[model samples]
Each structure stands twice: as C-alpha cells, then as structure tokens.
Target: MTIDALRHSPEQLRARIAAELERARNRSTGLTDAVDGDDLVRQHSPLMSPLVWDYAHIGSQEELWLVRDVGGREPVRPDIDNIYDAFQTKRADRPSLPMLNPDEARVYVSTVRDKALDVLEHTPLEGRRLVEAGFAFGMIVQHEQQHVETMLATHQLRQGPAVLDAPAPPPGAPAAETEVYVPGGMFLMGTDLDPWALDNERPAHAVGVEPYWIDTDPVTNAQYAQFIADGGYADRRWWTPEGWAHRSNAELTAPQFWHDDGTRTRFGHVEPIPPDEPVQHVCWYEADAYARWAGKRLPTEAEWEMAARYDPESGRSLRYPWGDEDPTDEHANLGGRYLQPAPVGAFPKGTSPLGVRGLVGDVWEWTSSDFTPYPGFAMFPYPEYSEVFFGPDYKILRGGSWAADPAAVRATFRNWDYPIRRQIFSGFRCARDV
Candidate 1:
C-alpha cells in the first residue's frame, strides 16, 4: 500500500502507539533493568539501553515527531538529533557514547507517552486510519525488537545464551547430493512503494526464471564427505576460474571445521560423526563446489523464497514450517539450547504447508542474490543500516542461526557475509530444473 493512505492524524496515532508501548514495557524486551531501588550506577546495559534509556528514547522519539513536528510544541530534548536517527548513527562515530542515565531516559519515554496520550484525546477521528498509525507505531516496536536482540548479542560473550545446536546425524546414511529446483515463472518480487522498500528492493520489478529442482535442505557433512571422497576438491575442472583461484590462495581442501571425527560440535559433545547435520562453516566457494559436483545450482533469493513456500502436505503460508507459533524447545533447532545441528527431517510438525521444513529457524540459508535492498527501500534513517553493504559481492542469507535471537529469524530477515570466508555458522541449500 502507498504512504499517503497510511499516514494517520496525530490523536489516533497516539492511542495506537500507547497500547504497543505498554506491551513492550511489560516484556523483558531483551534489555534487563536493575532491581528497583538498587543503587547501582549502571541501571541498564549500554550495549542495550537501561530501563530509563529505552523508556526515554522511545518517548523522545514521540516528542520529536508528534509534539514538535506534528503538534508544534518546542522540543523537550533538542539533542534527540544526536541519538535517534537510525540511518545517521551507522555512518558516524558514536558507537562508544555513554548515553543518558536511567532516570533521565525513563523521564523522556514517560513524558512522550503522557504528552502523546493527551494530544490524542483531543485529536479528530474522521479521516484517521489505524493502518498508518499502526505501521508507524509498529516501526517503533520493531526498532525496540532490534535493540532487544542487540542487547542479547552484546552480552553473548558473558552470561548470554550459547550458540545453536543441531541434532545428531542419521546412522549409516551415505552422504547425499543436494539440488535446487529452478522454478521458471514470472514470480512477483519486491514491494512496490514510492518510498516503500529500501533502495535495492525497490524498482518493484518482475524477473522471468527458468523452472528447476533444488535440494530440500542445506548440504550436510554426510554430503560433503562424498564430495571430498569423489575428488570434488582435488580437481579444477569443477571450479570456476575465480573460485579455483580463491581455493588455491587459501590452500584449503575440505570444509573449515573438517577434522578427524571428534571435533567439538556447536552442540555439547564431540561428534561421534553425525553426517546428516547440515554442513556448517563452508564459504560460498565450498557451497558452489558442492553444487557443481552434484550437477545443481544455488537458488536466487527470489527462488529460495518461492521454494521455502513449497509445502507438500498443505498449501498455505505458515509463519514457520512447524506452524504459526514462535519456536519452542521441541521445534526447529533454535535458541542454541541444543548447541548443534539436528538431523535433517527431525522436525515434522514444523514443516510448512508445502512440506518444506526449517525455513524460519535453523542455520541461515545462503542465496545467490547479493545482499541488496528491495524496490522502494528507504534507509531506516540510520546511515550505516543499508548503504554500507550495497556492493555486488556480499551474498544474502535467509532464516536465523541456532544461536541467533529468535526474534531475528523472521521469514524476511536477511543476513549476508563475504563469499570467500565461511564462519562456523554459514551453510546452504541447492536448486535445479525439473
């Protein structure tokens, strides 16, 4: 939908935002607050805001926009320009700022809430739409969601949750080749807003693709073993010139974590050799090699999204393959509480309507598309958000890793990394034509 139809009157916006703000405040929100009345100097995390910072930051945001811009009141804190701009922050040198104290911060958020409500009570209701107000308020909530995870990530080195774990490999199953299905069709891609999507996702255009088959899941260790055994790495014929050059330069023969059977897995114990656990830590070169050795190819972001929609059992868009609920301990290998990859086909209930499972939570799936914005992408006002990574090289990955915050694993959240280096967490699925 267009932005014009989305904007709301100031009063209606306030009431809608108030409900969301309360919901977020009640939740742990990824940012833990100090015990009430405790005299600790640091009331909240600088990595995440303290209780005061979050409340004030959110409130200041309302004040800047609603009171000052919309309602025309002078700003309570004109310095908001220093902290809030999402796009600008990324481009500057403020990553180390010791921000506002808890008390002052909360005052800001609370003040905004109070003033926002007061203004809304007298606002006109005739032409205001909840949709626009919802989107705006939702943006604020989503911004909070980001901090919630950021706070978790910054604390990962401390008492934060451990990395995600996978299920043990199936016993005695020979390593299998993976494939990608090439769906040749005029598929609808990108959101069409005049200022709707980020710059890259925009130019809302359609691409004609050829139909093909892709692997249902990412290539696992069992599959990689066969590639090595079949001399996939030793031969240069299977590699592209650039791919071969990279391989030679790195002096690499096998996947990054490949050692003699008992390596410490992302899961708790040493591997007795779980072959079905999706192979982790391989770079784009390795994934491409595996695809080449198997006579298939990697799917583009569009293709990957389309295949992710495939459900052999049902025909609907489910939030997760397991269904529309947030992941639980028994669902896909998430929260890293398991500490490693699960065997393929482990979560039956998590399968999508088309029988495609693990699309939402698992090792992030790499796609052929470079990490670029969609049509109509508007930078989130944070300079470092989108412009820093528009180069042609960075690859796009979907889904969230086991250790990634569950909130980060939404169907649309994209991840990217360079092609030559494979971290312990990266992996991929393949695609081919029928």
Candidate 2:
C-alpha cells in the first residue's frame, strides 16, 4: 500500500507479490471468459499481441526473472523463450507462432507461480543482486500489472458487445481557476529513495524550470470537441511535422476509440461522450494540436513534475500529490475500479500543493518532454526495461491511469510510448507560459 510495503521483509514481499499476481490473473481471466478461445488467438490490433500470448508470456516472464534469475534455478521451459520473446517476435506474427493455447497457458502459469512461490519462501531477501529488498519480486509484480493494462487495451480495441464493465467515476465540478501557476524553481525530479522505482526513474536530480501555468485538471471531451469542430486536425500548423505526417497517413480525425456518432467506445461498447469526463485515447499528436488550437502548450516533463511534486511551504517533494500515503478512493480513480477517466477536477482531494487536481490517476497525462535518462542514471536490474527505449523518439507520460496498480503509481514513475500511440489510456492537459 505504501513504499514501506515494497521495502519490507521477504515474507511480506512474497505475500504482496502473490496478491498482485492473483489480481493480474483475475483481470486476464475475466477478459478470456468474455470471448471464445478463437478470440483469444485473434489479433485485435497489430500493435499488441494475442490475448493467449500475453497470458502465457506473463508466466514465462515470471519464470525467467523470479524462478531462474533471482532464485538461481534452471529454466522451467526454455523452449518457449523465443516464442514469448517480445523483442524477437513482432506482434502481427504472434498468432502464427507456436504459442500455448488458453488452457495450456493457464496451467503453465499456475505451475510456474507455484514453483516461484516455493523459491521465494526459501530465498534470502538481503545482500544479493536481484533478491535484495525483494527487487525481483516487486519488478515481476509490476511487469504482470503492466501486461494486465496491455490486455485491457486489447479489450478496448476489440469489437463486440461490452465484455468488461465498471461503475462510472464520480462526477466533477467544472474546473476552477482553469490553470495553476507553478513557481519557477529547482525541484527534485526522480526517485532515489524508493526501492521499487524502475531504472528510468532512478538517480533523482534537481531540475530548474521556468514558471508556467498548467491546467487544473485534464482536458475534457467538451474542450477537445471544440478543437475537432474548429478543424484542428485539418490544420498542419498546429501539429509537429512528424505528427502531421503521422496523422495524415493514418487519416486521424479524432481519438482512436471514438466514433462519429458523438459517442466514445470502451471495451467494445459505445456510449455518449460524458462531457465532464477527461478525454482519453488521445495520442501525443492530437493532444499537441488541441493545445495549440487553445493557445496553450503541453507542459514539459520538468514543469509537470514541478507542479506535481514541489511544495512551496514544506520545501520538499512528496511521494504523491496528497503526500507519502497510498492512494485512497478519495484521492483518485484507479485500479480499474472504473473503466473510464474520472471527470476533470473529480479528485480535488488529490490535488497537489499548488492546487492541481487529478494528478495521480484517471489517465496518463502526456508531457511535452522526450523520454531520456537522468544524470547518474544506471541500469538497475536489466537493460531491456528502460535503457533500450531512451531517446527523442518516445514522449514521456507522467501520472498513472485508471487501470494502474496502486503500488506501481508514484510521483517519480515514468511511462513512455511512441508519440502516435493512442490505444493506451492516455490523455493530456494544456499548459502555458507565464
């Protein structure tokens, strides 16, 4: 529930990992039951793998890390390594590959988990490479949760009656003030103290940012509709050269899952757009164009962190907007308790010291900064996790989303994707110069 939980003893860490693994399996199982086995193998989108492949890969990855790497044990099934290797196999070719069917995947994951638990029970939790502070366990849990989010995205892209459901987020009042002015100052920008932080967020450093104004909450459907009505997408000046080219190539008129009938799609169901809810499924290009049309700009990653973490009064950055405590229902709409974004300004209780609302969850807010490493950044447990993707090509997204796990959401957490990616639960708010 807190950072303390992540840094706890071997027994506590084992229990937390077990619970999280179960949670991830429950989500995957629910999606699997919603359709037939054929649906599981059918590629919903070329960007993502088949549902069955994700199911088995989750097990394979667990075995690779917890069972084999940290536990110093032999591989459970070395032959399946190449099949589930994400870097080796392209997504479009996954269905043709020799992947385990749904039943076999389920059984394999169950067996792998059983063996991993036995290893956890006996392994020491201190003074080791991966086992120190239960790093491998936490990493494996987070990895599974990340895949759970990916599988949920596959559900959103698939077409049919709604296979998943959750209650709507709490209503929100119209955003007050419209923008919060963040003072220009040097602020600590990443996590050095949190043991569970990923490699990209390590080696916290001080960053100097100019004073800027940020939206009080995420941009809403009503606001984005104005951009669409104004022919924002038709105009090339508002988009970056690359963004424009991508948009033109894809013929993107609006967010990926939105329909032409004034309704938005979620988990294969269509419903009228909730004017108050934060606009989601928007890519960096659309978000950028919307900001330009509104006479604003996307906040730089440094500026975004300054607003979310700096406390003028306390003179120290807090772990979350509401301080060093785990998120509660009052704080944010998270853990997929709701299937959609909470309306802008919904979680006022979660506002930062400068009164920025909905800073932690509901949607992953796209910042203007490129994905890059901090000063003194070093590869922690592996190179493939974050080091492989650092560059100007990928944009950074701060904050967690509705589907994000509680333990994995932190102020220093970093998420990145290609700027054109819109299928993930992504949205943005506008920022402006002072």
Candidate 3:
C-alpha cells in the first residue's frame, strides 16, 4: 500500500491512537524508578533526544498544534509553552528545556495523554477534519518509535549489554553474502507530497545517478575497527573538511563506545562490541570515513531506496522495498523486543529483493543526500518541521534502528541529522559502481 492509503479518518485515527495509548500505558514499565535518568536521556546521540521527555514532548505538541489550537482552546498551561517544543531546540543538554523531576514529568505526560484522549471522545469524528489524523498519528507513531530507540540506546549506553530477544536467523542463514547489484535508472526520489516529513526531507526532487552495487550487510564493528587500526581516523585524506574538524574538536579517533580491548563498552556498568554484531553509535562522519578508507562511498538516498525497493514488476516508486505493507518482524529488525541490532545475515526472509538484509531496520543508514525540499513542497501546517532545516548542515538518513516499531518502518520514512554527530543507531553501508 502507498503512504497515501495509510491515512485514517479523524474519528478512526483518534480511536486508534487512544487504543494504542492505552496499550502503551498498560504495557510500558512506565518510569517507576529513575536510576537511569542520565541513561534515559540520549545525551550522546545527536540523532536522538532524551527518553525522559519524548512522549510528553510530542504528546504535548499534538495538543497545542492539533487539538487545542484547532479547537480554539488557548493553552491552559503557558509554563509548558516552550517546555515540550522540539523543532525550536538543539541538543537537550543545551538547557533548552527545564528538567522535571519524575513526578512532574509524569503528571505532565498524563495530562497530555488524557487531554488527547478526551478530545478523541468528545470531538465529533465527522465534520471536515481540521488536520489529517492519519498524518498526525504517523507523527505520533514516529515520535514514540524514536523514543523507544533513544531508550534502547540509553539502555545500551548506560547498561552495557543489550537486552536479548528471540533468536534471529542463524548466522549465514542468508549467507555471509556478496555485493548486490542494483540496476539504477530514473526513479521518483522523495515524497514531495508526503506531508509528514521533517524540514530536511523537503524538496523531494528528482536526482539522476548511475547504477551501483551496495553491500548486502551494514558495516559491522569488526569492520569499522579495521579502519581505526589502519589509521582511518588519523588520516586527513580519509575525512572531509567538516569531518576532520569535528574529529579534531572531539578528539575522537574511534567509535564513541569503543574501548581499548576494542570489543566492549562500560554501559551503566557492563562491557562492548561482540566481534560479529553490527556496530552501533557511529556518526555520519565516521561512516563516511570508513567508506573512504575502504575505497568506496556511502549510498545516495536514491540508490539505497532503489535497492531496498527492488521488484522488476512493481517498480521502485513503491513506498517500501518489501511491497507497501506496513512492517512486521517478518520484514525488518525493528521493535525493541529484540532490544539490539541482530547479527548480519540473521533475517533471510527480511532481505530486499536485491538480497540486502536489514534495509528497513537495525541501524539508521546514513545517506549521501543532503536534506532538501521537494519541488513545490509545503510543510503540513506544522510550520517548524520542514522549514527550519533548509540550511546546508543536515544530511538525510533512511531505515530505522532496532529500537523503532516495526510498523513504523515504511520505505518512505525520512530522517536527517548533522554529519558530525555520532550516536548508537546511526551507521551506514558502502556503495560502488558495478
């Protein structure tokens, strides 16, 4: 199904969101303790925000933008005016928001959730919808999925080993693999008409490029360490000017969580990478450096999507590579139930038709495309979203991390971040000309 079909009517969407919220409120452990406060906030990942604030942040936002404002109710709590806003903010530690004790934060979250639910119950589902609920629900789902990711990253960052889950396919179930070739050609690039994208995904214009080959698997920790041992981090020739400057400033010569023994990190109080696992926490700059050191380059967004959407009969214009179906574990490594990036070759059934595994999940893939707008693009009444990042800094990334909800992993989900930042969920794959 196309993204356009997922749009739900106002009443139906609200009912679904309310039901989903009930499930979440029932299922989640729900911050009963705060020992992991620092861990809960994804302070180290520029690609993520602190978990303590995510739901309330966006839930509160939907109220202001979608419900309250739409219904003509002035905000009841002006103190919250800027507290939950994300579009105007930068890093969480930059003091953009006041830190709330767990209690105040809980109260704030409850109020927002309840208010949205109340609106759903009271507002007539019928009249011309003020905003598209499906799109709004998509934003909520995306926002929550990002938090679960931040939480997983926080768990790994603070707790060391990831929480385990049902075993994925045996190693090499899909073979250790070889470079898969994508016969590229003219393709529609972005959802210029997709109303839900962030500012960086705007101006979804057509981009022409030649066909190329991309690795069937994402770059693993063992592979990245080889770059470091080869002085990939130390060499100026391997890095772009911005990347070099960033490395110089951060004094980062290895992955953020890399340790001397080189295998494990001390999350919360544990250890680091297993030789076979896919790497986590590397930034876009690091991915680029590794690609350069390996004598290759990161995939352009178009090439990445083209491979992921392989189907000679269906065409790459389809929303996701695995047909247009909303994702399930059968399709990707999403949802935190696994709680970690699986070993490469673990999901044979999940591979793109081109035989690329983990295209929809595992780690968010850094793309060579710049975050730009589609032709004749306009933000979906959420003014700050696509208009804010029209600047030159942000770069596009695709796929979702292991922490995201599988249902949220559409081929069209667009994410963007500055290249210099490093966090656990952002890593990349290599592409070269056939």
Candidate 4:
C-alpha cells in the first residue's frame, strides 16, 4: 500500500505541506543570499536559468497550481505566468524576459505562499487530483525544492569565491570489492500507488531482468581520474559516435567544473578532488566512455532499479533502498546538508537489499535508458510535467543528489537531462553481465 493510502487527515496534510514548503523556502532563500543580485539574474550557464528566474518561477508555479488551481481563485499576477513558464522561454532567453527582480520575486513568493496556506486550511485532503491527499501541495513543494537544487547548480557554476558552506561528510566504510549479484527475475518496477509520484513513474509493471553484476558503490573520482590519466577522453574507440562528437565539439577533458590541472569546483569553491568521493558533474557521454574504458557498461534503468528496490526473498519491492521509512542523515547525505557528495558508501544505512551501497542521495547516477513511459502511463495534473519530456531525446538519472529534498527522493523518482549536459551533479556506476 502507498503512504497516501493511510488516509491522512486534512490537518495532517496541511501540516505536511506547510513543513515541506517551509523547507523549500528556506533552501531557496539560502541560495539567493549566497550570491549578489548580479549572480541571481546572470545566466551562469546555458543549461540553467538565472537564480532570480528560478525564484520567481517557483512562486509562479506555486501560484498556478495551489493558489489558482486548487483554491479556485484568480491568479495573483497572471501577466507573469507566461514569463515564468519554463516551456515558453529557453534558459538563454530567460534573463532578458521581464522576470521579477530578486526583491519582487521574494515578496511575490512569500505573498503567494501565505495565500496558499490559507487555501490549504479549508481544502479537503481528498477529491480532485490537485487536492487528493494533498498531491498538488506535495507537487508544489517538490517543484520548489527542485528549483532550489537547480539554483544550487547555478551557484556551483558561478565564477566566484565560495558562497555556500556545509560540514564535510564523515568518511565511509570500505565497500566490499565484489560486485553485488542481482538474480535474474521478473521484478515489479515503478509506483502504482505513490500519490506524489510523477506521470513517468506510474503503473508499476513487471520487468524481466537478467542476472547481472553491479558495482557495490558508485564509481569514484579516483577511478574516473584514472580513466582521464590514461587518455580516455582522447580515445574514440571507447566512445559512441555521438558521444565522441559531443566530446570533440566541447573539448571536454574532465567532468564539468573540473580543470585539466587536477582540481575541481564545488559550490563555487575550488579544491583538489576528494579521490574517494563519487565523481560528480559528469555527462552521459563521459560516463559511457568511462564505462567502456573499464570494460563495463552503464546500468540500464531496469538493472539499477532491480538492484535498488527488489527483494528476492520477499518477492516485493520497497519504497526506498532501505525500505519505506523516510530518509535520514544516517541513511543518505541529502537536502544540501553538505553541498557536496559524500564519499562512496558513506551511508551504509542506505544500502539496498542486494548489498549495493549509496544507491540514493549522493549524486544522481546515469542509467542507460531513454526517458520513456510505462505501459499504463497517464499524465495527471498536467502534461507539461513529464509527458512532454518523454522520448530518446533525454537520458534518465536515478537516485537523488545530495541537494535533493528527502520528500523528493524515492526509489522510483526520475530525473532526466540531455546527454551532452553535465552541469548537474550527475555520476554513474557500472553493471556487467554475470
């Protein structure tokens, strides 16, 4: 049964929504203060919008979904809706749009949030998709949190001194050298009942996966460094034709945010890479080439899920690697607690039933799967969320990153990006034929 099946009371749902929104607001505010106004509006990279745009966009979406859709109220500022519509404008063009300035963005979001909470107080927890078990509220919280993560990425890409700070993660236990074996079987994948689950993650279905050997932990910086040291980027034989073209055109020598001189940047802070940490900011092309260099392959989304959520003895899947309990610091390094990836295997409590480590909350692991829908998939709330993004044009990334909100991190959560983009905190582990 899904968590929503528990029949949360309207009050309970209100509290949950309030708490999640507060967390998201706090994170966004923190990110906003990390840089000056110029940084907030400047497009740090072509891949993402300026920080101020994200700030206003968060409010715009919340207003669109919660204040207007759920509450049946007129928009607070309908004129700005198209301006903040992510689909209407490209990232490069967003800065030039009439986006609300940082101060106006903050005020707008705060005003909308207060009005949304008032609506939440009167709305039933069940009914339409927007209100059912507080799904729309949950969706808004997730959306805002997602923007916080994106803004954090922008901060990482910004050229400046360190602005964000967090305590370093404690060292991890040594991971077992042997690959974890996922026995071949038909395992149920995706979520049929997770009320907050997106359209792409619906209608759990059986997937027949062959037995395979997967790395016990994510590939580390040291391991990837070895690939680079061996001239992996220069070797075309290891790369797919498209991957080589991307690499050749971009002249990428290392993961994004890394220089040829053996140092990496995190949250705008430059330093030598922690060799044991899981590699971050790697594009699918780079990850695929590294897998080829190591005589392994990026795990298919099925294989990755099978390793992460399937329990052979129970013949059932779990809500997370460590079961249905909500994630904690001991389970994973998430919610921007450390602003950087923990060392691989740091969260032993987060291990999957198959003994795979760091399966969630470190860095998003690239899977060799296109962003496609399941057999019975149907768009809910809106088509723009996931339906439009489905196809071969995007690659899937499973497992949330360190900046990911706990509420947003789930065994079936799906994140997608273009194969050539690398600014996000993305990494990969390898799987091989048993």
Candidate 5:
C-alpha cells in the first residue's frame, strides 16, 4: 500500500492503516527475533537503547496515542509508561532501568496492539485534528517504523556474526553528469497540506534559494576514500575548527566500521568498500570536510530541498524527488528492501525534475543547516519531538536512508543529529554556488 493511502475513503484507509501497522510490526519482530533474549535486553551501544526498550516503547506510544488519547480507553500498562518514556530516560541509562524483560515486552506490545486495533476500528476518521484522515494512526505507524530503523542500526553495532541478511541493491548506470544545476528562485519549502507530516515539516513557507549546483548522486565511497588518501584527516584546512577538533579527539581516520585493508564491516560482514555505493556511517564533520577538500560545500537545507522537491517547470514542490506519488521499490532503496545503500544512480526513476538522484533514500544526506523550526513553527502532540531540538547544537540531514521506512520519510522530512555522531546511516553530496 502507498504511504499516502491514508487519504482514501474510510474503509480503504482503515485497511491501509492496518496493513502498514502489520508491516511495521513484522519488521520489529523480525529484527528482535534474529537474536536471543539476552541480545534484546543488552544495550548494543551507548548510542542506542536496548532492542527490548524499543520493542515495548513502540507499543507504549501506540497505546498512549491510539488506545488512550484517540479511543478514550483505559491504559493497557500504565506502570511501564515511565520506563519507556524517551524524554524521561536517556539511551545510556535505559539498560539500567526497570524495563520489561524480553518476554514481558513482547506480551505487553502484543496486548497494546490488540487494544490499538480495536480503537482503530471504532475511532471516527474526522472532526478532531489528530483523528482527521487518520493522522493519529499514521503517526503511530511512522513512530513504530522509526524505532524499527533504530533497531536495525543497533543490529549493525552489535558484536558477532551477521544475523541479518538481504540481497545487495541493484547496480546503476554511470551518471552522464556529476552535478545538477538548480536555478535561483522561490519554492515552497515545507508542507502544510500533508496530513501525516510531522509538525516541523508543516506550514509550508516560501524560500528563495540562490542558484547552485548539487551532486547528481550522493558522494561515492571512492570519492571519500580519495579525501582520506590525501591526508584529509590530518589536514585541518579541509575541516572546520569544531570538525578538526572532533576528528583529532576521536582519531577518525576513516568512516566508522572501515578498516585499513580497504574494507568495511556491514551488518557484521567485512567486504571491500564498493566504490560506486554512497558512503555511510560518516558524521557531519566528515561530510563537511570531504566537501571542503573537493572545493565544494555541503548543501544548505534550502538548497537540498530545492534540489529534491522543486519543479522549476511546474513552479511547485513535488512530494518526492520523482513526483507527488508515494515511493515504490523502483523509486528508491527504502523500507529495508536492501540492508545497505544502492549504488549511486541506481534509482534513475527516482531522480528529481532537475536530474538529482538518490534524494529519497539510500543514506540520509547531511545538509549544512542547523535544526531550526520553520517560520511560525508550533509544536503539535508534544514539544519533545521537534521543538526542544531546535538550535545550532544539531545539524540537519535531508533524504531518508536505506534503513528508513517510506511511511516516515519524505522530501521535506527533517532529521537532525549531533555533528559528532557517526552511528546513523548518513552520507552527503557536495554543492557549490553558481
């Protein structure tokens, strides 16, 4: 089913929601089931919560929004609410908390799903802000899918043999051009019409971007390797003061999981780094440095959005790079269809009107922008989701990763992380002013 299927008739929308919920749950369970109970409870990395926390946390949120708030039903398991509250507890401290055991977490989430499904059946699809067009349900589905992606990242960090498996992504024809030119003009930056879009992506506003050139496809591993080969890490000239400081302190010679033998570990398997594939696990600092080394700069958030969504011919922003239609396998490498990013230019059909490719998926692209709210931004449902993170402390990443779920990702969707963080599946393309 399409991600925008939520806008259909009540009957079709119900079925679509149910299918998406099931799809997300299957992913959550599949990842958790691959390892033993011990693995689920143990924190794989301080950067991520235990897999079990995510499991129950998914259900806790579903129950809070769907069962209690939407349905006006009694809580399924109020005792564990604090345990899974992300804001109340941080990732590093979660493993120490009284979180539910693996078996208990499974049972709790299952129980909550049953109640949430019942609420879905009875809840009206109109009137209220949250329920209108089943926004609440869509939000829950996206929430669960987001956690599922997080679990996938945790799996990548866990020690041992590869427990996950997926076919490699399709190869791509070499791009005829390295960079696509975007004309300077005004285009709607965000979305006010998209019902399921998070609050941060709402209230679409006009943004005037300067004409610039963006890489047609994400920067490849070979390109980044060249940066490293040229003493990019040792040279401070290519890096910002902050980036150089972090690089020195961390002794980051290459992207995370990369080894000296010209190979990288992916999902516990060591393989030669594919020169054609987009580089992943690099932080904002690394991407920025690489851009500087190449005599380019990371695209600003507005520039990135313009490249991904603005249709100069139509003078309107499309929902995705390809068009307003929801993403399909042919559109991008999304929904964990492949465990790793496709080769750059693999999804030609996903290319934007301006000939930019790989904007929807593969790896989250770091943009040279702070994680700030749009003009006239307002928090919805809660403040912790977006409002609290607004500032220069976090750098924004555009485009979704291969690990991202389609329902949770869009051209306007904004993801932010600390500049020093390298755990996320992130890559970047260079841009230069015309």
Candidate 6:
C-alpha cells in the first residue's frame, strides 16, 4: 500500500501497523541475536536492564495493551507480568528477578506478536481514543523502538569486542554560516493533530520567544575538544554549582569513553576521535559547561523547537525541520542505519527553513528546559508514560539520535532524563541572546 493510503483505509492501516510491528521486532531480535545467551541474560550496566528482560518485557507490554486491553483476549503469560513491569521493577534489580531466559523470551515475544496481529485484524480502527487512527499500535511500535535504542546504548557500554557493524555516515557539507538568527515571535510549540504524539507533546500551544542566534549545526567534536583543552571542566566558573559538584565527584574530565591520549572507543574499537562528527555521550552538565566556556548557552526547549519547526514566512510549525512529512534516510541518519552520528552538516536536506541543520538526527540535543506538561495537558492511555516523570528533576532532550527509530521521534516528540546521565547518545549546540 502507498504510505498515504494507511491514513484513510482500514486495511491499509492494518498493513502499515503490521509492517511497523515486524520491523521493530526485526531490530530487537537482530540486536539480541548478535550476542550469546550469557550476554543476553547479563546486565551490561546498572543503568540498563538485561537484554533478555527487555525482550520479554516487550512481549508483555504488547499482550497487556493489545491482546488483553484492546482485543479482549486471554492472557498469554499472566504469571510474569509484575516481573516485567518497568515502574515496579528497577533496572539494577531486574537481573535477579525470575524473568524468562533467552530461549523462553524469544518464544514468548513471538507468541505475543502473533496474537497482537490477530487483534489488529479484528479490532475496529475507529471509536475509542486508544485505537483511533491506530494510536495503540503506533504507541506499541514506538515503545519497542525506544527499547531498541536503549539496547543499543547497553551494547555500547558492554565490555568486550564490538559485535555490531554498519557503514560510516555520509560526509558533511561546508556550512555557509556558523549560526542562524531566529526572529522573535509566536509559534505553535506542540502537537494537537498528531495521532501518535505522547501525552506530554499534546495540546499544542502558542509560545512567545525572543530573537536569538542558534548554531546552524550541532557542536562538533573538534569544537568540544577546544573546550577540554581550555580546562573547561576544571574551571568552576563554567559550571553551575550542582554541575561542578557532580563533575568533581565523578572525576569527569572528558566525554564518556574518551582516553587522555586523544583516542576514544566507538562500539568496541579504539580510534582517533572524528573531528567533524557531533560529540556523543555527553551529559547535560558537560554540554552546558562547554557552551559556557564558548561564551554561549544551551538553547531552551522553546528556542530549540522554534529553530527546528517554525517557518517565519508561513507562520506555521512544520511537523519536522524540513517539512510536514516523515523522515527518510536522505533527510536524517536514523534507524540504526549508521551506528554513529553522521558528521555535522551532513544532511542538508534536513535543514529547517531558517537554515538550522541536523535538528532531527545525530544526537539528542540537551535543552535548558525542565520536563513539564504543556498548557492544558491531560493524561492519556496511561500516566506512567509521561506524567510520573514530569518535573525539574528531569531535563529535556530534543531530536532523535542515529540509534533512534523514525517512528519513535518527531519535531514534537519529547525525551527526558536526569542531568547527570551520559550513557545515552547525546550532544548539544549553543545559542545566545540577540
């Protein structure tokens, strides 16, 4: 079916949903299958779960939402639901749980997927909010894809030979300017019409922003290296008191995985740091300190969104930086096509109307904004997805990374984490007052 047909026809929507479900499963299995049973069952790091847990948890979520809730079908594995409950179980403790083993997890997920597809066939696409426009299926697709990204991060942290491989990203183009000026004005900041946008990104509202200058592309490794060379990490003036305390306690002198000799680990291979690629694995504190050392600051969430989605002449926010259309390989480096971020300024086609580039793919850009609900926000489907995490304790990150799936990210999508986290694929650009 044509991509557009899925929006109007029930049969086409079901087909699209099935394709997405299968695609997510392929990525999940590919990551797990590359390693042995021990690797799958062992927790690579305390920050993430055992690969086997994620595998079975994905199946449990599908069964809970699609089979039991949406399809009114009997439970496939009611006995292990609590063991896989993310909110109830912590990552550090999941390895000790009596979760399914690698072999059993594979079978459990396969059975759940078959039942989910059956539900998709019988359930009407209209009526309730969850199933409307195939939102539930879309949510599940996004959920699985998110876990895939998390699994990729765990793989990065694994201590051993690299088992993953992918072609290098395309070379970058020369940027005409270092920074682009965004005029002060009002723009719609979130989504109201997007069927799959999570609760935090809903009820689009107008936000008034002031004129500012934002980097045309994300800050590059070479530029960040300058900050390190200038003793940015040791200089107390560059970091907030909280940031300085964490940096001192953790002894963080460079981005995670960097060696004092100027080489860094990528996947598992040691190589010279790519000067042109966007810096990855940086915490918000590090990004903020680097920005301060450069006499700039991280962009606020509103400013970042404005630069990414607003078109001054049209006075409308496009669904993505380039335009109101879904992402493709040419537009952004996404869907694990490349294991690492494309070089800054690589995807000219993905540039926003204001000439800001690389806003959608490469790394999750840290913003100064705290994670909070938008005006008129309401809980939907479940509150655990977003509501429970809303507050200043979490900082916001925008855009998608190379590991992120296209279905899981958009201009309006929101990701949040503690400010001290550096394991995720993250980076940032700078902005300044005009």
Q: Could you tell me every candidate's TM-score relative to the true structure? A: 0.61, 0.97, 0.84, 0.98, 0.98, 0.98
lDDT of 4 by residue, 274-373 (tens): 8999999999999999999999999999999989999877989999999987888899989999888999878889988889999899899999999998
Clashing pairs in 2: none
- CA-RMSD of model 6: 1.3
Model 1: per-residue Cα lDDT over 1-434, one tens digit each: 12333355555455545665555544332244523323112322333333333445556666765566445676777876576554445413333445556566666666766665555555443343322334334444544544443333332313223332335422222223334333356544543432222334344456555677767666777788898889888789778788889989998777664665545333223345567777776788778888888887777887776555433345333344555455665566664444456677666555545345556555777777898777556665444646688778888887666655443354445677788856436678887757
Quote the lDDT for 244 in model 5.
91
Q: How many pairs of residues collide in each model?
A: 71, 0, 17, 0, 0, 0
Query: The CA-based lDDT of model 5 is what?
Result: 0.92
Ranking by lDDT: 6, 5, 4, 2, 3, 1
What's model 2's TM-score?
0.97
lDDT of 2 by residue, 32-122 (tens): 7777898898998999899999989989999999889877788888999999999899999999999998888889988898888888888
What lDDT is reached at residue 26 by model 1? 43
| Candidate 5 residue spans exceeding 4 A from truth | 1-7
Cα-lDDT of candidate 4 = 0.88
lDDT of 3: 0.65
Instruction: Report the lDDT tens digits of candidate 6 across residue range 136-193.
Output: 9999999999999999999999988889999888999868999999987999999888
Tens digit of per-residue lDDT, candidate 5, span 1-434: 34466558888888888988999999999998999988999999999999999999999999999999999999988998898999999999999999889899899989989998899899888999998888899899999999988999999999999999999889887899999888878999999878789999988999998899999999999999999899999999999999999999999999999999999998999999999999999999999999999999999999999999988888999999888888888999999988999998898899999999899899999999999999999899789889999999999999999999989999989999999988899999999989
lDDT per residue (tens digit) for residues 54-74 in model 3:
645655665675467545555
